[model samples]
Target: MSRHEALNPDDHRDLRIQERRDAALGDARMVCIVVPAEFRALQAEYPILFRLNETRDRFSALAMFGFENGENLYLADGRWDARYRPLAIDIQPFLIGGRPDEDGPKQIHVDVDSPRIATGDEGVRVFDKHGRPTPYLERVIEQIGELDHGFRESGDFFAALQRHELLEPFTLEVTLEDRSDNRLVGYHIIDEARLNSLSGTALAELQAAGHLEPIYMAMASLSQFSALIARRNRRAARG
Candidate 1:
C-alpha cells in the first residue's frame, strides 16, 4: 500500500521530509538494508547480519535494529539515538526507480504515502523554488547510488564467503533482566574460527581481494548485542 511516483521536481517542488525518527514516519523497521560500504560505520553501532532475499535470489547485508521484529531500538522519542544512522534508513521514501527515459539516466522515485513526505515545510526540502533538487535531496541521490554499488559488491562478497565455507548459522540466546530467554535464529554470521583456520595463501588472497576487513568487522560487531540487550531491559523496565 505504497503510493510511489517518479519524482518530478516541478510537481513535487513543495514536498518536505521530516529529519527526525518516528515510527509513524515509516522508520519503524527492525532491520535496515545495508551495503558493504556501510559495514565499517554500521558495525560500530549495530550487529551486521546477512539476510537472504528469495525473490532477488541474492544475499543482502542488514543492520540489526532490535532483537525482535517490528522493534527499532534506535528510534526513541521521534529521534534516532544512534550516532551512525544507516543510509538505508536515511534514504527514506526515496527509492531507486528504472530509467526515466529509454537511454536516459535513472530516476529517483518517492512514495507520496510515506508520512515523511508532506506539503508543509517542516524538515528536508525535496526541491527548491528553481525546481532543482535541494542539497539534501542531492545527498540522498548519492546515497542511493552508494547502495546500488554496495548491493553489487555484496553479492560477490557473499559468494566469496560461500566459496570459503564461512557462512554459518547463528542462534543468539540472551537472558534478559527478567530471566526471559530471547532466542534469535535464522540468520548467518561470519565463522571466525573457520576464518582463522584458513591457509596463509587463502588468507592473503582474501585480504588482497578486499574481504578480510569486512569479515573481522562482522565478527567485532557481535559485541554490540550487549547494547541491544540493555535497550531491551530498559524497555521492559519502563513497562
Candidate 2:
C-alpha cells in the first residue's frame, strides 16, 4: 500500500529524496509510459510501442527497456544508461493530486512509503533551512507539471491514430546466443503500410494537429530494437 501525503514545507521540511537510480528504488521495469512530446528524445534511445489499457478502451505509449518483467537493461551499476528518461519515470514518488471533489488546483503529493525517501541526511533536500523549496524541489515540480499535461494530451494522439487506422498488433520473437527463446506479445506498433496509404488530406490533417512528427519518430524508434538486443546479449555474457 502507498501512503501519499500532500507535499508542504511545514509537513516535510526536512524531507530528503535519494536521487539515485537502482532496482531497489523501483527503476527496474521493462517498460515506462511515454508521451508524444517526449518521442523525439525517446526515439533516439528506446523503442516506442503502444499498448492497450486494462479496459482495452485506451492506448498508451511505452518505452521498452528490456525483454522481460523486472528487467531494465539500461540500469547498470546503480545508474540509468539512457541519455533521456521519460517524464513519467523521472517524476517518481510524486504525483498530482486534487481535492476529493476534484474542483481545485492540482497539488503535489508524495508517496511517503517510497524507497526513494531517504532515511538519513544523505539525500537531496526538498526544502532549505528557512522552509523554502530547494532547486531540486522546483525541478521536480516542473517535471510533475509536464507529466500531467502530457498524459492528459495523449488521449488526443491515440484517438487520431485510431481514426486513421494506424495501429496494428505486434509480436517480437528473439533468440539469444545461448539458444534461449523469448517472445513478446500483446503490444501494438504503428502500421507503416496503412500510414503510407493515407491520403494527402489525411497527412495534412495529422500534420496540422502536430501528430505527424511523433508518428514518424515512433516508427524510427523501432530501429533501437537491435540495440536493445545488443544490451541483452552483453548482459548475458557478463553472467
Candidate 3:
C-alpha cells in the first residue's frame, strides 16, 4: 500500500530520498509507461511499444526493459545501466496531484511508504535547514511537472493513432544462445506500412497535431530489440 501526502516544507523538511535503483525499490519491471514527449530520448535506448489497459478502452505507450514480467535488464549492480531513464522511472516516490486542466495549482504528492524514503542520514535531503527547497528537490519538482504535462498531452497522441489505424498488434519471439525460447505478446506497435500508405491529408493532419515526429521515433525504437536481446544473453552467461 502507498501512503501519499501533499509535500509541504513543514511536514517534510527533514525528509531524505534514497537515490538508487534496485528491484526492492520497485524498479523491477518488464515495462514502464512512457509519453510521446519522451520518445526522442527513450527511442535511443529502449523499444517503444503500446499496450491496452485492462478495460481495453485506452492504449498506453511503454518502454520495454525486458522480455519477462518483473525483469529489468537495465538494472544491475544496484544501478540502472542506461544514460537516460524514462521520466516515469526517474520520478519515484513523488507524483503530481490534482487536475491539470483545473484553475487551481497542481500539487506534488510524495509516497511516504516508499522504500526510497530514507530512515537515516544516508540520503539526499529534500529541504535545507532554513526550510527552503534543496537542489535535489528543485530537480524533482521539474521532473514531476514535465511528467504531468507529458501524460496529459499523451491522450491526444493516442487518439490520433486510433483514428488513423496506425497501431498494430505485435508479438516477439526470442531464442537465447542456450536455446531457451521466450515469447512476448499483448503489445502493439506502429503499423509502418499503414503509416507509409497514409494519404497526404492524413499525414498533414498528424503533422499539424504535432504527432508525426514521435510516431517515427516510436518506429525507430524497434531496433533496440537486438540490444535488449544481447543484454538477456549476457545476463544468462553471467548466471
Candidate 4:
C-alpha cells in the first residue's frame, strides 16, 4: 500500500487498530498505545476497553502481543510517525473519584524525555557535550521537541494510547541505548482502565485475571462535554 494509504482516515481508525494489534501479536514486537481524553467517554460506555492498559493512571495498554521491539511510535493531530522512540514516560493523574483540592484545574501530566539546554531563546542546533550538532540527535530532538523547564511536553504516545486504556494492558519502561559512545535516553507510561470501573463481582473477574488498577477512575470524566459538539461540526463538514 502507498504510505498514505497505509494510514487510516479517522473514520476507519478502528480497522487500523485491529491491524496493528494483529501485527504486534503475530510479530511479538513490543507495542504501546495511548488515547486522549476526548475518547474516554466511549470507554466508560463499553467496559471492554480496559483490557489493554499496563498500569493504573497510565495507559500503555498492549501487553498481549509481546512484540519486543524497543522503537516507539507517536501519533497526534492526525499525524503519525512510526519510528520515534521515547526515552522517558511520566504520568499525572487528574484526581478523579477523590475529594477535590483547590490546587488547580484537574488534569494529568505526561512528560517524556529529559530536559536539554538550548543555546538561546530562539533555540539553535542541538549540541553534544563536546559542542557538536549530532545528526541523529537533531532528528531525535526535532521528533521529540527540545526539552526545557518551560517546555513540559509528553510525546503523542501517551495521548494516542489514552483511548486504548479501555482495551489493552501493558507496562512502562525507562531505557537508554548506546549508539557509538553516546547514549540515547527514553521512557514510557502504560495501563488498563477497567481496574477503576469494576465493582464487586464484575470487577473481580478482571482482577482475578491479573487486570486491576483503573487509570480512568482516578481522573474525573471530561467536564467540558460541549467540546464534543465542536467535533460534530467537523464531522458534518466532512460528510
Candidate 5:
C-alpha cells in the first residue's frame, strides 16, 4: 500500500528516503512504462515495445524486461545489473501530481508507505532542519519533472505512430530456463514491413516529427531478447 501526498516542507521536514536497490525497492517489474525520449537509452538494455493499457484505453510504450509478470531478470545480488535503468524504474515512490491551477508547474509527491521511505538517518533527507530541500532531493525533483514533461509529449508520439500505421500486434514463443513453454501475446511493435513500405514523404513527416529515430531503436532492440534468455538460463543454473 502506498500513501502518496504532495511533498511540502511544512509537514515533511523529517522525511528521508533510503537509497536502496534491493528487490524490495520495487524494481522487479516485467514491463517499465517509457517515453520516446528514453527509447534510445532503453534499447541498449531491454527490448522496447508497446502494450495496451486496458484501463486507460491507451497504448503505452514499454521496455520489456521479462516474460512473466513481476519477473525481472536484471535483478541479482540485491542489485540491478543493467547499464541503463529506465526512467520509469528510477523514479519510484514518486509521481507527478496534478495541480489545482491548470497553468502551474508539476508538483512532486512521495509515497509515505513505500518501503523506500526512511527516517533513521540511513538515507537521503528530503529536507534539512531548515526545511530546505537537500541536493539529492533536488535531483529527484529534476528527474521527476523531466518524466512528467516527457510523458505528455509521449502521448503525441504514440498518436503519430498510429497515424503512420506503424504499430502491430506481436506474439513470441520461447522455451525458458525451467523448460517451460511460454507464449507472450497482447503486445505491439513496429511493423517493419509496413514501415519499409511507407512512401518517402511519409517517412519525412515521421522524421520531421522527431519519431523516426526511436522507431528504429525499438526495432533494433528486439535482439536483446537473446540476452534476456541467456540471463534466465544463468539464473536457473545457479538455483
Candidate 6:
C-alpha cells in the first residue's frame, strides 16, 4: 500500500487577500538623511560607490538596498540588465532632465521601481512603483535632487507633494503573487500615518536633525488643511 498523507488543500493553497491580512500589514515612513556635499569618500567603504564630475562640485552613486526579504532590486534598467549604477552619472540632462528650478532638484523622467531591502539605516526601507517596501535608495536620491531644487525655487521642500499625487498620500500597498502561475493572491494598503506612529523612533531621529520632515498625514486637522489651500491660492494670485 502506498502511504500518502491526506492534505488540507486550503492550508497549502494560495493565500486569499483576507487570509494574509493578519500577517501582512501595509506600512510606510519618511526620513530625512543628510548627505554631505562630499559624499563620494564613503562609497568605497560600502557595497555601493560613485565617481565625481570634472568640476568636483557633483558626484554620482548607486542606490540599491538590502531588504527584509533578502531580494536586492533596483530600478529595473529596462534597456540594460545592470541593476546597480551611479544614478547621478547614469541619469542626467537627457534621461532625467527637467524644467530648471533654482531651488528644487532638477526634474527628470526616472521610472519608479518596486521597493526592496536597503543596506544602511537598519529597518529603513523605500517605496517603489507599487508602494511595497524595498531597500532601494536611488529613487530617494533622485527625490533629493528634486527637493533640493524645489526648495531653492518654491522655498518649500514638500512642493512636490502638492504638485504630484502619486508621491503624496504616502501608503504601503502589498501585492502577493503565486510564484508558479504569477497570479496575484493578496493585496493591502497600509496608511503612512499608522506606519509613522509605529516608527516613532525613526521619525524622532529625523526631526532631531534640521530636515524638512515628511508628515505621513499632511494635516492633523481639517482647518489646517483649508488654511494651507487658502494661503497657496493667495500666493498664486500675488504672483
Q: Is candidate 3 or candidate 6 better by lDDT?
A: 3
**Per-residue lDDT tens digits of candidate 4, residues 100-125?**
22233222111111122122333223
Model 3 clashing residue pairs (backbone):
none
lDDT of 1 by residue, 107-202 (tens): 788989888876566787888989988899989989888776666567668888888988788888999998888888878888888998899998
Local accuracy by lDDT, each model: 0.83, 0.91, 0.92, 0.28, 0.84, 0.28
Q: How do the candidates rank by TM-score, highest first?
A: 3, 2, 5, 1, 4, 6
Model 5 scores a C-alpha lDDT of 0.84
What TM-scores do the predictions have? 0.92, 0.96, 0.96, 0.21, 0.93, 0.18
| Candidate maximizing TM-score | 3
Best by lDDT: 3
Question: Clashes per prediction?
Answer: 0, 0, 0, 43, 0, 23
Candidate 4: residue 86 Cα off by (Å): 8.6
lDDT of 6 at 108: 31
Q: After superposition, how far is residue 125 of candidate 6 from its true place, in Å?
A: 16
- The model with the greater lDDT, 1 or 5, is 5
- Per-residue C-alpha lDDT of model 3 across residues 92-167, encoded as one tens digit per residue: 8888887643444689999999989998898899999999999998998999888888878988999999999999
Q: What is the lDDT of residue 197 in candidate 6?
A: 49
Task: Give, for candidate 3, the lowest lDDT window spanning 10 residues.
Answer: 96-105
Residue 160, candidate 6: alpha-carbon lDDT: 29
